[model samples]
Target: MRSSPELATSASLRYVDVWKYYSGKPVLKGVSTEFSPGRVAVLLGPNGSGKSTLMKMSIALVRPDRGYVSIGDRRVDEDPIWARKVVGYVPEDPVLYESLEIVEYLSFVSSIYGIDVPQSRVDAVIRALRLEEHLGKFIGELSHGTKKKVAIASVMLRDPPVLVLDEVFSGLDVESARVVKLWIREKASRGGVVVVSTHILPLAEAVADRVVIIHEGSIKADAPPTKLRELGEELEEVYLKLTGYSAEIEELVRALRG
Candidate 1:
């Protein structure tokens, strides 16, 4: 067993033999994986393939029916509050207090998380996401993309060791997406474990050090982008092939052209 200091700074997230079910339907089945420090892992899966559920498990917003998630020696399911202190999570649909201004909302997060250098960190992220202009506006009044920026800011400001971001780039514009990608790389370079899920294969290809593909409640593939794209295939092509979509797409093409 490690000391408290060591456990608090644990640099990796692990899931072992994890299983989850929704209304008697299995969403994840016997899944086991580990995310290492200094790397960015991209989770790729089609709709209803369980990517979101698996990501949610890392933060303990949802727990597995079996198995467990952990950071170093501490089990996330067993010590979720401790886990939250070390992991910064951005969900698929971020929930923020509608009536609060951007700065007030972030102040609330800062207080809740006990951030060490709250104002400086918040200022840095605000500038990075170009939110300085909207800091006084109520969170409810911002556009979806701007609101998403605030959500990203809330997590990134913490600079936590483990980050579980679900569809982070969905509403972001091109430049904001590019900036966030750079931030992701910077975070990983500093030895933070970053796991992001996205449907944009090109974006995933650009950001991922390794890719894990889930399909129908099982891990269909896991490999570095280069290996997954063997023989000069694109990441999208590889994903389609691995997830059994290539054949269906071919059938669609034939029918449409006929």
Candidate 2:
């Protein structure tokens, strides 16, 4: 396995009273949190609860309407390029150049980062993700899962200080998902900050050092996974309670039984 260079400088992702709106509807309301290096923070929320928006803002893909977001000393709004340089983002829906082959696309990404990495490093990641056979195929000709793998490999090649993954395991196969989970753990062990926005409770349980739950555009709970387990609760139970979905689920189950 390829390893990242020793990152002596520590970095943290911070959201200071951040807020965002779409067509006058608030999506993130006065949200503030910090993600520290050597930890994996998982953001969990129901659909439209701003999980994706938060992840996007961390990498400056979506600017906040109010408040500030910073990665280390660089403000996202003021210095997007510098902020992005420290982040390796896997968007919820990644866009790729259809005409470019997998290798060509990865090379382009490397160029954008202004880094000249050894081909051996690239080969290691491709092989880990089981993409060796498809490296020569055009991205448009690959399956969704294959495309997602390519996107992951591209970002992993950069080995940024901060890694943001939005629903990364959504379309991956069983083995692929397992590989990614292991990768996240390894990254955190090496003092890299990793933020994963996902609804996969099991994945969160496996990797999260801290879990932040968002409900209706605001933070509802922020605690370590052990806290939930200490309360004799599972992640799903805590999610439903904090989000006020227990009653709704009970009602649905009752109606179905009738």
Candidate 3:
């Protein structure tokens, strides 16, 4: 069993003027941000706001057309393998092998990291996420929420220093979502960097230490959750106000009434 690498306490995820384009249409426009260990930064935005793009950039799954993304001191594009070693990403759309059982899939993922994940660790996560019954089921037979649990378990097994979760609570049930929320808080307390991108307003309100509102590929608001509350705002209100969607929503409502 290969041992996990010792991560530096000061390791951080950074984006510097990062920009990306797909077929000449801009997706990210000079996005810049830094997520440090021991903090949970929630990225909130409407559709097409480049939240997912930024998460992908952090893990080197997508490269920026200009600027750079770094995990600690290593540029993700330049040292993808190293960056991946330190980061565990749970994407919005999780992909798994249909033929493999839950345990089999997790074992395969552990092998890729060359880490011998103990049976106890696997069992613990299964119990925590209420996935024990589904462990023997094939990935193809599992429901969307169950498959999401499998994906999350695989990432958690690695115990990486950095976690980038994009809408992780989407398919989860209420109980499962609550479990994940607590788990994220525990990870943050242990000095791990956690970045979550989601449209789930309540989840953001519950767990976010810092909230970043992105609109049209740019940061519109970045502040601590307490600061927002002090200003008499919730995440939803802040998002609506910063994204300039209040007027558009009113127009839609009026049209519907007409």
User: Could you say which candidate leads in lDDT?
Assistant: 3
Local accuracy of candidate 2 as per-residue lDDT tens digits, 64-130:
9999998777788898877777788898778999999999999898888787879989889888899
Minimum summed lDDT over a 10-residue window in model 2 is located at 1-10
lDDT of 1 at 11: 54
> Rank order by lDDT, top first?
3, 2, 1
Tens digit of lDDT per residue, candidate 1, span 47-80?
A: 9999999988887989999999988888988888
lDDT of each: 0.85, 0.87, 0.88
Q: What is the alpha-carbon lDDT of model 1 when measured against the actual structure?
A: 0.85
In angstroms, give how far residue 111 of model 1 lies from its true place: 0.6
**Per-model TM values vs. the true structure:** 0.93, 0.94, 0.95
Ranking by TM-score: 3, 2, 1
Better of 2 and 3 by TM-score: 3
| Number of the predicted model whose TM-score against the real structure is largest | 3
Instruction: Compose the digit string of candidate 3's lDDT tens values, residues 84-139.
Output: 87888998988889999988999999998889988888889888889988877899
Question: Lowest summed-lDDT stretch of 10 residues in model 3?
Answer: 229-238
